[model samples]
Target chain A: MKVEQILHMIGGVGGNSYANNSKLQEKAILKTKPMVEEAISDICNTIHTNNIVVADLGCSSGPNTLLVLSHISNAIEKHYCQYNRKQPEIQYFFNDLPSNDFNSIFQLLMLYEEQLRENKAADYVNLYAVGLPGSFYGRLFPTKTVHFFHSSYSLMWLTQVPQGLDEKNCAQLNKGNIYIADASSSIVYHLYLNQFKKDFSKFLRSRSKELIFGGKMVLSFLGRKNSPAFGDIFNFWSLLADALNSMISEGLVEEAKVNTFNLPFYAPLMEEVKSIIEMEGSFHVGQTQTFESNWDPFDDSTDNFVINSTLSGQNVAKYIRAVLEPLLISHFGDDIIEDLFSRYAQNIARHISIEKAKIVVLILVLKLKE
Target chain B: MKVEQILHMIGGVGGNSYANNSKLQEKAILKTKPMVEEAISDICNTIHTNNIVVADLGCSSGPNTLLVLSHISNAIEKHYCQYNRKQPEIQYFFNDLPSNDFNSIFQLLMLYEEQLRENKAADYVNLYAVGLPGSFYGRLFPTKTVHFFHSSYSLMWLTQVPQGLDEKNCAQLNKGNIYIADASSSIVYHLYLNQFKKDFSKFLRSRSKELIFGGKMVLSFLGRKNSPAFGDIFNFWSLLADALNSMISEGLVEEAKVNTFNLPFYAPLMEEVKSIIEMEGSFHVGQTQTFESNWDPFDDSTDNFVINSTLSGQNVAKYIRAVLEPLLISHFGDDIIEDLFSRYAQNIARHISIEKAKIVVLILVLKLKE
Candidate 1:
């Protein structure tokens, strides 16, 4: 199988509804839940609603997923008790592409099932969760059914790997790696822009149909400034593939089948995202905020195991496992793999700065008009 | 006859080669002499030249014509005496359309004959002032024959009245006035622009042929800013024509004679003029200056004779004299002519700021490549 096919299969795996590996996936969900809760609060205030139906689109399997559900439940419970009135019922939906590991998401929900029942108060709060597996580009719910919607860290993923990348005209020889030529940037940008416009317009239309009057949505995602100097991030995997080819050519490792890879998603500039939303015109802008994060801030980051445990989980570790051995062998010979974690620790202690590991997030909250 | 043809006829009258009456022509020439001397001094200072061959393109019948010639002569003579070297020879070619009043120009030149004989320096000065009556758009002399060229207040005369003004579409309404709608501002501007580009290109090519390696051309004419608010100036003539139609309809004027009337010349923007000169890549920009004439100055208490006299000797007064008087009388009644004049004079007295009457002058110097 081609390298692109392998990467696509992995992306498809994350997108599917049936995958059940919850233990490894739950950590990211837990970490992101508080941020999602803050976003939901802002969204509620924008809509002037104490009770609202919410959906987490692209809600992958993780402990963080239930934490988000719990946050919403707590906010609604507090609003009712303080006002001395009937509490609003909550219906939370977990959505992803059909290929995502939903069993893991389902298991995490089941674990929280008992706790939700025990805390049920007057006006009968309900915890109903369902897995929705489909492309988010089109209508997925009935008209005027949703009150608020939220999505995060997902919009930057391209629908498919770029075609014709292997063609001689598509790639140019630059130093040792095959880099894109002058016309490549425009071609890729247009290709991705067409897909994004189609998908985003459909998403807005679908949401507009489903949203009740005064409903709100909070979305956080990766974007980029429209400048010639910034290359489209869709090419990240292709560049990595080229680097791998160089390592393979140097006889760093035996030829082994590798089918799956991930694209790094970064937050885009505010202007580009605003342009798309404005073009759709279904929602009025409320608030936009940008925040930064440092994923790996340890002083001695050279201990690969410690850093991996702190920042990411098994999925990243598994992917890096294949390349790590080959990469270390090629650069420092076979014996260094055992001591590589110590070397990384020392290097991190000596040179790593907190600023270098930061990630930027941009949040946009919009309210749907009647 | 078309309006343009009428203007052409008037312009043609100033091109005649022999004098019909030398005495009256000499007096007009004398009256204009001082202005010509000042103009020559200004030109010399602008071009930084003490000795140069100066030709007046469209010299016509004027007392000031000899002054420009004599000024060139004096500049050369003074330069030679002061530097102890041979003075520059002056070859003054006075040009006009074939039908010009050249007899007057020649007679005025003859009146300076005795002064030339007494100078003694005239032998070395070598003044050869000749009449070249033809279109100034094409070559009239040998290559590199002249050093300076001047034309004042002449370019405003259009080469011909624009064609097709009598067409049905050119009439804005059925009342016999030409319609500005069909013959729009752009249409009029472009019509003149086409003629200018054609004529000026030929003129430049011809002048380039006659001008020495380093020569200067000074041109002054009536112009206007290309603004829609100021469209009144260009459209006013049409409105006056409409007023004439009103008079004819009322049995006060002859309709048959109106066809003979025409706008004399084109008024181009400063940028347009500069572009035409620079298009051939033969000349560089030297200076451009614009000023508006103030027709009134007093606080509405003085007689209006000053403003009236200023307009009397010019072509503008002669062209408007026929239509203006009747239009005023018909509109204001015979008894009010004095009142009309008094109102105009009062307005002038109140508002005759010097800035209003200023003219625009653009000077360009070209260096011929060997």
Candidate 2:
């Protein structure tokens, strides 16, 4: 299935829904607040227009959806207040795949507006929020219209699965693997790397055209600290593939389905991400950083001790399920979802108890070329 | 409950959904095509910018949601081609209540874009569709940003049900009626009229700030043909109230609930609409017309004979239920919806079999004054 058509965070406000289980993403937004504030300051200093257009690309439905926008607007408001200048109007575009739950985002906005009204400080800014539904791989705005763009935890999702992993095209390209797992051929690694290069380059090109001169973007997404294509990020998916393999042994899921089902995702090395941006040639790379979060998002302890690995396993499983369940259901059918995730949780519990596991996240700030 | 919080057309693609039952609204859109086309031409001739910002206020989700935008863009494209001018990019903002099914509209937009790609003529036009979820009774767009605005069958929905029609505020004001029925006192009639005036004036004032000088708006909504406090439009709500009263007699619904329940809607006289625009002093009325459609939207016969009263009644009931079910459920509860609409169908059938009922629709073209 086309990733844009099928991929979305679990919608609505249920236990497994993205709205409820999105603290990991919320943490990412919070972690990047300084970068976001810096970007806003740059925009305010450079752009002279009365209306500032900002977009949150891949803004899945959740509390985190507006968290970034609120940061940017508040920063802009503070900057104008510091200068004793009339603040410009802020027009925010919340963008995601067409399948994303924008209705929930709009609902959150009503409460946000109420909160803003109660705060007299926010009166200096006139905020307009619009939901934009489209893939970031293509153009979404008029040329030179957007002033700032922010996307979080979304770019790792490639436009589609690497072109030639299917059994019909090339047999055993990545057998018994849903991603670039350890057992797969070296060719599987290159296939994913190439896809990420193409998709990320396309994303940069599209945003470059949409952003005005010196327009800024702050993007944070899943990435890898290790130089190799198969990094610690693979372990997260490896456990999932293992769970699927166990189900296949019991004849609960078809082996062919497992063999063909690959995630349209690639956690790029930070070097790979920078190289793609440079290759795209339309953006000037700015501040870039990489950090690690534990596999269990709820486990914030700095120590390596695996305290309650079972609970951590379930927490990790829940976070992944909130993001990946829709894509999994599309390919494997939902009947396998409950059984597969439960097995995946057990596999995660077994592995993390022996060794501490963490996933790498990368942040980048870029500006449009003159 | 506030109308903005609870009011929305029935969502999703089901039998009772607004998407499925919006042929009535679609007909109104098609009926107002010439005026919409004229408004587009006026915008093209007057505005010099390369980007045309068009907004459809109260753009409820359905096939009809984009129908008016499509007409406006096609007209703009044709206008540019005839003049040998490069087509400017068209930015469409679909505004509705926060509870609107924006996800469905976004899904339809995907297909719409695919269709545009297939159409060779559309290649010259850059189309951007954004969902703006809010009420039109307030400012949605920035000052002097919107070039054209179109709203069909939506303006009649008042911002709220008139205040003080309740038993607590005033006893027996509009006793036993949810609207200005024939038996409603003159005080009740004035209450509805005064609310419509306040809401419509607020709507005009808000749009005036948003629309650029010479910006155009084409609005079509339910209106009154007869010059009286009680008109044919009253018959529509009176029948619905009759249905509720019957349920009250059967103890299926509470009498206090029916007494308090009032539609956040008004069917104004054409003169009342004109007076509001003139009083608001921002928009100059251009072209105005009135037309009628059968209460049974399926009945296209101009001679006004009920071909199948039962079938026509059911169709009418479905159309109304699609638009009003959420509001009804919010106040009275969902348990009474099916029974209420079914009983409403029988009441409509009995009345229309003898009288051949029709509802008045008013169309107005307004241009923003400098």
Candidate 3:
């Protein structure tokens, strides 16, 4: 299936919706707040125009979508105050795939406006929010128009699942696995890496054309600390694969289905991400940082300990389900979702009780080269 | 209820959806195609930039939304070819209330892009479509950015249901009516007219700020040919009011509910419309036309003859229901919608059998004053 056609967070404000389960992603945004502020300040100082076009690429709906806007606006507000400069008008473009829940974003904007009115006086920044629906892997704006771009927890998604993984008359390259795992052969790892390289390079080139020279972008997404393909992030898919495998053994699901399914995502090493950006040759990396976030968003401990493993496992599973359930349903159908996730939660509980699980996040502040 | 909160065409592609029953609106768009083309030509000639921004205000979802885009692009394409000039990039913003069905529009956009790919070469116009959700009664764009604006069949909606229509312990201004019917008091007529004047002036002021000096706008909405509060358009609301009264007498609906409810809409005469544009002072009226359309969209007969009045009545009722059902449900509850429209259909059929009913539409092309 095409990744762009089906990849979207669970929509609306239901119990299982992405809006409710996006704390893990929000932490990453908060982690990079200083970087975002610096980027906005740089743009304000360099770009002399009074109107700035800022876009949030892959801005899935909910409070987080507006959270990004608030960060940028607050930064601009602070920058103008510090520099004693007149506030500029900002036109914010919240962009994502066509199937993303833009309705939720529009609804949140009304409340955002009301809150802005209550907090700020007449001298506040004039902000206009618009929903732009399309993939960021291609051109999304006019040339040299956007002044600042921000994306969070979105670039790991490939434009499509890796091709050539299913050769004619050959077993699937990543059989019994949905992502790069220990069981997967070297060829499987390389295929996923190549897809990421192609998608990320195309993304940079597209944004470079859209951004004015010296325009700034702040991007944060999942990555690995080490150079190896099999890192801590793989545990997410491995546990999910184990659940599907158990279902297959029970004759509840087909083994062939598990073998054929693969996620259109890759958690690349920090080195690999840096190399691709250099190879793309359009952006100058300004600031970069890598940090570890626990699999369970609620577990914010400095040491390697999993307190209440059962609850932590459920929290991790819920967050993952919010991000992946729609894509899974599109491929595997709805009947298997409940059973698969429950077993996956049980597996996570057992595994984390023995050892803590962590996911690495990478944040970057890049500027378009003149 | 706030008009912006409750006023939206029936959403989705269901049986009662606006998408399925917008032939009357489509006819108005086609009739004004020449005016839209001329406006595009004027903008292309006067504006020196290769990137033009055009907005369609109150662009509710469905084929009609894209139809406006097609009209503008075709105009741009033809003008460039005739002038032997390079085709400019057009950024089309589709604006509507937050309650609109923008998801349907985004879904249709994929098909639009695919069709463009198949039908044209790479040299065709670069069109980027974005959805802007908010009321057109306020500013929606940055200063001096928009080059052309188009709105169709949407301006008849007042900002609210004429504030002060209900006073403490006083009789309803327009008793036993949902609009300015013949039985409506002069005070009721003045109330609706004042609302329209206030809303239309605010709309003009907002668009004038968004548009570049000398930018053009083409607006078409329901209007009367002569200067009178009770024109041909009154039949539409009088019939609907009669239907509600029937329900009130049958105990299906309450008298207080019917008395308190009035449509947040007005159809002004040509003189009133022209006078408001002159009073607004920011626009130079270019071209104006008034025409008649059959109340039964399917009845194309020129003479005052009603062939198969029942079918015609049902078609008319479906069209009106597509636009008003949601608003009615919000005010009177859902239990009365099905019965209300059926009774409205019967009333329209009886009225048209005696004499054909018609609706007047006013079209105008105005340019922002330099």
- Pairs clashing within candidate 3: none
lDDT of 3: 0.89
Question: How does model 1 score on DockQ?
Answer: 0.00
Task: Report RMSD (Å) for each prediction in the order shown.
Answer: 33.9, 1.6, 1.5
lDDT tens digits by residue: candidate 2, B213-325: 87799999999987666666898999999999999999998888888888889899999999988998998999999999888888889886798999998999999999999
Better model by DockQ: candidate 1 vs candidate 3? 3
Q: Which stretches of candidate 3 lie over 4 Å from their true place?
A: A121-125, A166-171, B122-125, B166-171
* DockQ-superior candidate, 2 or 3: 2
Name the better of 1 and 3 by lDDT.
3
**Residue A254 in candidate 3, Cα distance off native in Å:** 1.3
B207 Cα displacement, candidate 3 (Å):
0.5
lDDT (Cα, tens digit) per residue for candidate 1, span A1-370: 1221121112212422213223222333444455555655554555554336677776644554566567666765665566575555465666655444444555456457646646655323344455554446554454565776777655654444234332334433222222222334565545445555656666777788778776667676655433532433323223334444444566642223111122212234677667878898887877777654333322224332343432332222233333233333433456534443333333333332222332345677777754
Q: Give a tens-digit lDDT track for model 1, residues B1-370.
A: 2221122222112322122212222332343334444444444444444335577776545554665566556755564566575544454666665445444454455457547767665433255455554455655454454677776555655454445443435433223433222245566556556666666666777777677665666665556665422433444344355555555666655555344333435566777877887786666655555533322212123332344433322222233332233334433346533433333333333332321332233333344444
Over 4 Å off in model 1, which ranges?
Answer: A1-52, A119-125, A162-186, A224-243, A251-267, A295-355, B1-370
Q: What is the lDDT of residue A7 in candidate 1?
A: 18
Interface RMSD of 3: 1.5
